[model samples]
Target: MTATKADRTPYLPQEPDLAAPLRLFCFHHAGGSASVFSGWQRALGDAVSVVPVQLPGRERRFDEPRIRHLPELVNALDAQLDPWLRQPFVTYGHSLGGLVSYALTRQRAAAGRSIPERLMVGAFPAPHRRHALVDADRLDDEEFARRLVDLGGISPTLRAYPDWLRAAASLARDDLALGLNHGIEAFEPLPCPVDVFTGDRDPLMRENDIDEWAQHTRASFSIQRVPGGHFFPWDSPALFLELLGSAIAHTGTRRASVA
Candidate 1:
């Protein structure tokens, strides 16, 4: 089940190890891309393959129009990621990514399709609660960009690039709509385990809201507070890698080899 040249797609920039013992399908925060996980392979060693899921309108997918709703993005991912789903894997998403990952899993469960071994969400609020920044959706382009930048949603260094302001704001606006426009929906809890974490200093993801993730999964649930702001994983790469690696070394399919 090893991937071939034909399996490569813009959605997944890196070659995948279908043969690996485990794979982690990562989704990036709004305004971010698969490049966020560029060093993850070396950081985690060969034990697990880190495959970042690049949503449209960012990175190489920049030419494509952005998807503004949650369901549409989930459906698109359902088809694009079918090949990688054949192997044992988990899903780790940050911020808006966490919401996308959760929606995708719920869709798979409803269809009796393959779901992740574990779902790990960082710096995100639980599904049912309206995200704290949902109101930001109403801001004008300029104000919107500034607000996101201040909240650490978009990097300040990107400001050097002339287009970063407008481009980042556009990407963030469309991506943010995935969660902002969608009302909460309830379903039978997922059959898989769910691990949740929040940045200790993040303004968007309150610690209390993180615990609500427990209601989304019927299996074992865990929550921890990591150091940093909304972008903790990048701000504290070593610590984040340590915590993430520990979560992967669980009594599950990660230990089981593919034939």
Candidate 2:
């Protein structure tokens, strides 16, 4: 299937066997682009193909308006992602993206399509476990910006530019709205397993919150704490790659069915 601007701009590095046993789709945090996963192709190598999901209003699609609600974004992705599901896909989502990943998995199951082979949640707490603390949508611009800085998810260069600052704020606001408004309607665990990754120094995610993710999945639940803060993937890619490899290695057997 042909790719589109509305759909995430996927980058494939050194084509792996197109029919490889496993494909990994990565969703970046808010104000982040698919480029975040560019290093992953090399890190993952031949065992798996890495495809990064690019949400609208960012990177190549800068002119598009940001989507502000969870359901709308999820629905948009559900349609765009349908043709891309080449079987036995696994999803890895960080921060705001984690919620989207979880919802997408549920939607896929509800639609009677092949469910992801595994779900990898990173940076964020389980949807149900997030504390009713700071709501980015409700925060003033200054407060919101501070929250982003505190989370250390946005880059310093982007934070310095006015245009990028506004764009980042808008994207952050919309994403926060989407994440906060996500619905939890009787979510059943996937038939496949799930792995959660969190940073030991991440101020936003507590260890217990990560542990709570176990309830959302009936499959074997595991959590690993990396060295860096919330943006561990950027700070320590080597360690991140190793952790990711371990997660993928644990799912060695060929999946029987995508569904």
Candidate 3:
């Protein structure tokens, strides 16, 4: 059974059997929700079961306050995920979610808990790399809204509508706050392999930033260049599916034995 919000743990989505060889856990970027991975489940093929983790204060969990601390979120998730650790799994996170995935793995390692068999980070820099960043979260409401629109990820249609715009701005502020406050102390590569993917035109990540993920993973590391901008997965669903299928297949062959 999945854990509930009252349990003070991360809540896993309800799904089918757990015997699948490839169980992929997906985490969303800032200001996004589990809905982002809605179509991915079917596109990933029957062999691979896609489990998307829903962060608090978004989508159906709108009542829940947004989580600002990465470790706090990871700790809560770890508590719930430990039970499911009985089976092999892989983690796939995008942008902010990528950092969350890595942090979660580290937390598991520290507690001697079972960890994912592999990690897949997309459109995000390596954890150990220093970044010249800003504190958008500290800005006033008006300024925070301006920054969100400037970022260009939020849908223009939503920005046009006042209610949607207000909601989006709130989420953007919380997401930025989470990123700004979160810090990576050190790097300890997971026992599993790592894969990094990025859009050739993604302005957020430089070529070196993408390549440097290799240094953080003692397991095998691979990088791929997909088409489109930062949100390439949304831009090219078919291509993303192809790459995801390949990753799942590779995981089945290697499992957690890669070194």
Candidate 4:
């Protein structure tokens, strides 16, 4: 059966910019919406186009069913993003989104498709590393909420709204299951350069674990520690953006040097 036009729209909606030289596909953390990257275009200016990837069951896609498995999620994204792959693009994913970006890049490479110019991951460790935090999926609601709060995953606004909290918690559990339980048996290093960013104080991440990402990338690998906790991107948008801009700039410089 043919999918309808509504089904064809990319999960994240953005004004089309065919002329932009580079595209930065931004992926959000667990239970996060594209709104997490709202106003990034204005912040980034015209040198690069900022495109946020919206996962299902959140914000505008609230009606869609949530996907719990990493493979399933990235497969769906691969289909939606195939057309956009012709352009020079990079991916920036935070936490769970980082895994999604990395997995998607590998999936594309395995299929001999166009891969991103760069991969920027934040607040996530290498795929082979086991998560050190307690399993929130196994916790009772009260404990789950408290754990999320401790991880800075839950906000005060979410606490005030029972309906929102329930929905958010449900999505978060699905993501946590995928991130923590799923293990990759065999993996190949990616061809593109990788830049990893992590919060200095994020409890879920460790310097050694973050450094392990270097082994998964055959190209240049770099890691930077920014200030704040797990939600550092939200805590310090200016610093995060500065780091992001520098990464993008470095990619451009390298490409220019090679040319």
User: Which prediction has the highest lDDT against the true structure?
Assistant: 1
Estimate, for each residue in 1-259, the C-alpha lDDT of model 1 and write its tens digit.
6456776677887767756788899999888888988888888878888999988887777888889888888898998887778778888999989999999888888887778888999988888888876787678887888888888877788777758688888888778888875766666788888999787889887656888888987888998678988888877888888888889888366422111
| Regions of candidate 3 where Cα sits further than 4 Å from its true position | 1-10, 130-134, 138-152, 253-259
Model 2, residue pairs in steric clash: none
Error of 2 at 148 (Å): 1.5
Clashing pairs in 3: none
Candidate 1 lDDT (Cα, 0 to 1): 0.82
Candidate 4 — which residues are off by over 4 angstroms?
1-8, 253-259
Better-scoring candidate (lDDT), 1 or 3: 1
* lDDT of candidates 1 onward, in order: 0.82, 0.74, 0.74, 0.80
Best by TM-score: 1
* lDDT of each residue in 1-259, candidate 4, tens digit only: 3233344465657743667788899988886778889877887778888988888877778888888888888788899877776677888999988888988998888888778889999998887887654266668776776677788887867788888787677778776766855666488888889999999899889878899999888889999888998988878888988889889877762321111
Model 2 over residues 1-259: C-alpha lDDT tens digits? 5333444422222233355667788888877778888878788877787878888777777777778777787788887776666455788998888888888877777777766778898888878765332266577776777677777766667666868776677777776667664667457766667789888888788767888888877778888888988888877889988998888877765552434
Q: Quote model 4's TM-score.
A: 0.91
Model 3 poorest 10 in a row by lDDT:
1-10
C-alpha TM-scores of all predictions: 0.92, 0.87, 0.88, 0.91
The lowest-lDDT stretch of 10 consecutive residues in candidate 2 is 8-17
- lDDT per residue as tens, model 3, 139-207: 776666665565456776775687888788778667655566466756666777889989888767887
Candidates, ranked, TM-score: 1, 4, 3, 2
**TM-score of candidate 2 versus the correct structure, residues matched by position:** 0.87
